[model samples]
Target: MSEQKKAEKIVGVKGMNDILPADAPLWELFENTVHSVLKSYGFQQIRTPIVEPTALFARGLGAVTDIVEKEMYSFTDSMNGDQLTLRPENTAGVVRAALEHNLTYDGPKRLWYVGPMFRHERPQRGRYRQFHQVGAEAVGFTGPDVDAELIMMCQRLWDDLGLSDIRLELNSIGNAEERNKHRVDLIAYFEQHKELLDTDAQRRLHANPLRILDTKNPTMQEMVNAAPKLLDYLGEESRAHFEGVQKILNHNNIPFTINPRLVRGMDYYNRTVFEWVTDQLGSQGTVCGGGRYDPLIEMFGGKPTPACGFAMGVERILELMKASGEQYAPNQCDVYVVHQGEAAQLQSFVLAERLRTAGLDVVLHCASANGGGSFKAQMKRADGSGAAFAVIIGEDEVTANTAVVKHLRAEEGAEQNQVSVEFDAVVDYVVDQIVGHGHDHDHDHDHVHYHP
Candidate 1:
């Protein structure tokens, strides 16, 4: 016999994590909360392609920014020789879509997105190469009212998610003209302390001197702190715009601190930059970051338009949610249908479909190596499925056209509390019990429970 070649296992790419079943409950909780919170703020969802032109980011995010220079996953397509990149951040892609489709032609539009973004970075807690972001962009809005509204919306989400200790820090980088003047002093100041500037800082000295102020190099901290604060250079109009956002936030009782060193990774952000930071998550403490990018639409070949948005890291927030000590059950389905015998198997399928038709999640058990597993074995699988109810059918029940409903989540050591119902009445009986149980827990505090 010829030698057989062995097959080797191929694993997922590093830093691209799989959302295993065990962790899915927490992810579902976070996503559902986000959808509800965004909808409350009148923001509608917008989805864009994962791949966009390489030049879009090069021109939009500034070629010198770390995201464009080091982090972006860009390549030239072999098929058509078109330069493409998996988006590192979604703001640019969102703006490109809006411009291409004239989405804002009618008037201003509020859009939101939730999807994965690609970035090549050392993976660690709360960060990955393939990470998900839930962002909201208010396009064509020209005032600080929207700015404050977006921040308030974030606070509402944190509150709803039972998160605490995440604080907001704000600053204004000023308009292009104002930033130019600050850039001048920032370069000169860093030039004096050239020895203190790291290799990255030295390279960015003239090209992007402002970003050095955001450096985490401990050696350069003292010098960078003394570098010109952008807030000191804000023009009267920029100052007024920043104050307007603050006035609204203060009135709404959203507390924040002014961090002069707070700067965004992108060059597009002009004024009113802010970050929601936390003591947790180690060095990657920024849970969310965003700012007003008034000039971006014009830069994208659209008319002069004002826009502001924010994106929160889904993994990071989930980590915080875990720390909050909330528990979640991995509910695969609401009802698990277990059957034995040929006739019971067919009847189980029919009953499952009917339950689903009534808007209930149902799981129908199938025979394994042990054909028509004893009722004992099938019931074990049902208990492990995280199902609240189990519909048991055997040859006897098939003959009688009845199903035994077993309460799966009943109190510890409590009776199974099995109920026998006709096949025609199974759907109504299951739904009434589920719905009535919810009402008792939510409203009827004095409701009595039936025990064996």
Candidate 2:
């Protein structure tokens, strides 16, 4: 085959990845943790379409934002000439759904989403073009307590993940008019120091000078210190709201740093913005980050509703957990029924189903050429699967209406204590053996025998 054809057949597209089954347990752990936390907090799941009308995001996320300007995977639809884009974030689409479905008609809604986001960018460690996010949003509440609750939920998620060394950075972007005044002030400040600004900063200085404060250019960084502060320009209401937020956070004993320069990239955000940064993963810092986009609902043509939300990057969190030696134990399969022949395969299936109905996970041996790989290989696969015990069924055991249940992690060259149990008693016997005792399967073996 030609190189191009070979490449097309073998490799995933750039900036995309196939999450292999080996990593699935980690994803499940994080996903389940998020669901548990959200459920305890009374957040309902709201799924939005992956592709949406281009105008929805263009208007809601702001046209000049980086997500709209550079990162969006936008294309014209072949069926309907309507321009469409794969969602880069959930908020805009969620807000659009709330408007179209008239969800805001009744009252405030606490909503969340967990799914993929598409962004065309240089893929790196813990970052992918198509990545998963677990996010929550509270619509129609402007109180600081709502903000504090969101922050607390984020902390809860981090705690559940067992992530350490995380820092909370909070900021207020102020109300619209105050923010407008600060924008003009920033433009004037950067214009005076234009000579020191880098090309990007110089360009942003005129267009959106507050973005200059976010620039990483050393010269711009120095200018940022002297740049205008949003706090000084905060209107009376904005100031009081900010103070209320601080008070609530203090009441909850949540530590945070006020970053005056922390302007969210989206135009809809106002009043509060925060980020959860960690030092665990090298270079890639933010594991979770989001802010209150109070004006987004109205901006999307819904009745005015205040909303706050945050999205946790699952891949980033997993990477950090792995780096910190936080192990997510693999999913436990209750029984691994090894079949010696086609007849045994049928018998194993029946036994596996019985275990399944009893609320247990079971994996059956499907190897056609059974003797090619040794019992050791079978045991390794069973152990790696985190199965409770190995059910070794051969012609002898099947004919006798019983099977040998071997301890999967018995010491090498040591005799495995096999329990001969009637076929009907197998499920109960295995459950008693696995869950009743602290059995160690020694899953940390260096060699991996991949089995499904």
Candidate 3:
């Protein structure tokens, strides 16, 4: 017989991925932890469109940068001739949305976002074309306290995640005029050694000279080292602002390094630029990166609002947790219901619904009457699910108006503790056993419905 080729079935796009159930718990933990921390810091959430006008990124992120020139997913919308692109980053879209919605007109807006970002890149352990980010931005605040507060929040987040071994690299790029002077000087300096620069560095030299200083090429790095430092070009106001930020960080006892060559990958960032990196990860090591973007609001047609924020890669954090042996146990339900027979199935559904209404994450499985497996199989499934207990209701239990709650984590050869509770008081009784709350305690029952 001729050799047969297997039919290919695509799962994920090149840079995209499917977050499997095994990994989704970690994602949930990371998202919820960050969201709660941001809320405690008084930051609100804002959601902008995933699809934005192509020019927004080209201008906000810089046309000369790799994001615009190479990584962006740009295409012309068939409905309208306007070119559209999936957002590569959050700041430009956030700024555009703030401008269009007049969000900054009333007062300073503290916003946060948790979503996916699009880019065209090699899919690595932590870097992906379709990656997720959790970010926060405080707009219309121009004080050094705002800068310090943002950094403190980041420190708080890393601490909460139990992620140690992270370093803070801070720098200041100064105001527009001072930065302009620095850019001019950098271009002139690199021009003298143009032949030593890479093609990418050479192209950026004319378009955005400041970017040339960020070149990773060995020859370009040598040239960059000879360039003038930004602190020397910082105008009086810029110098004082930078100092004020440092003093606040010092006051908070947050350790940081002054990386003068720390130019962010985005163009809109100005004044303060910083990155949080950890050596725990491999060569690709940046975990969080962001900075101030004072002119972005004005560029997007809104009032000149000063903004600073940072975004952390969720995948990167998870990878670090995996590597560091930092145990982050997912929140698993206390009980699961496995039922057999028509009557028992109905009883399980009713019991599951009642348990859910009482604020428990419950899973219900319908057992077939064509002879379900031995008790060992059911116990194995419950253990694999990481559930603390399992509620099994067979025909006999259903007829007796009760269900068996078996503790899944009981030691080997130990007697399984199964509790028989009244059907009417199942929800209340189970909630009490699981959460240590009395059945009669009054709690708000209003449910919130979120529309995507």
lDDT of 3: 0.80
Name every residue pair that clashes in candidate 1.
none
Give me the runs in candidate 3 sitting further than 4 Å from their true place: 1-8, 367-376, 411-416, 436-452
| lDDT top scorer | 1
Best by TM-score: 1
Give residue 322's error in model 1 in angstroms.
Answer: 0.6
Per-residue CA lDDT of model 3 for 1-452, tens digit only, reads 98899989867677688887778768877888898899999999999889999999988887678898899899998887889999988888887877888887888888999899999988787889999888889999998788888889999988988888889999999887888888788778888888898888877878877777666677567668878888789988888888999999998899999988888667678788888998877766889988888988887776678999888888898887777676756556666777767898888888887777666677776465764455566666666666767888888988899888876666677764667777776666666555552212223323312111
Q: Cα lDDT of model 2 overall?
A: 0.80
Model 3 worst lDDT window (10 residues): 443-452
lDDT of 2 by residue, 161-270 (tens): 78768889988888889888988877887778778988777666666666777776665576689888988998888788878888988988889999887777777889
Range of the 10 consecutive residues with the lowest summed lDDT in candidate 1: 439-448
Off by over 4 Å in 1: 368-372, 412-416, 439-452
Question: Candidate 2: deviation at residue 396, Å?
Answer: 2.1
RMSD of each: 3.9, 5.2, 4.5
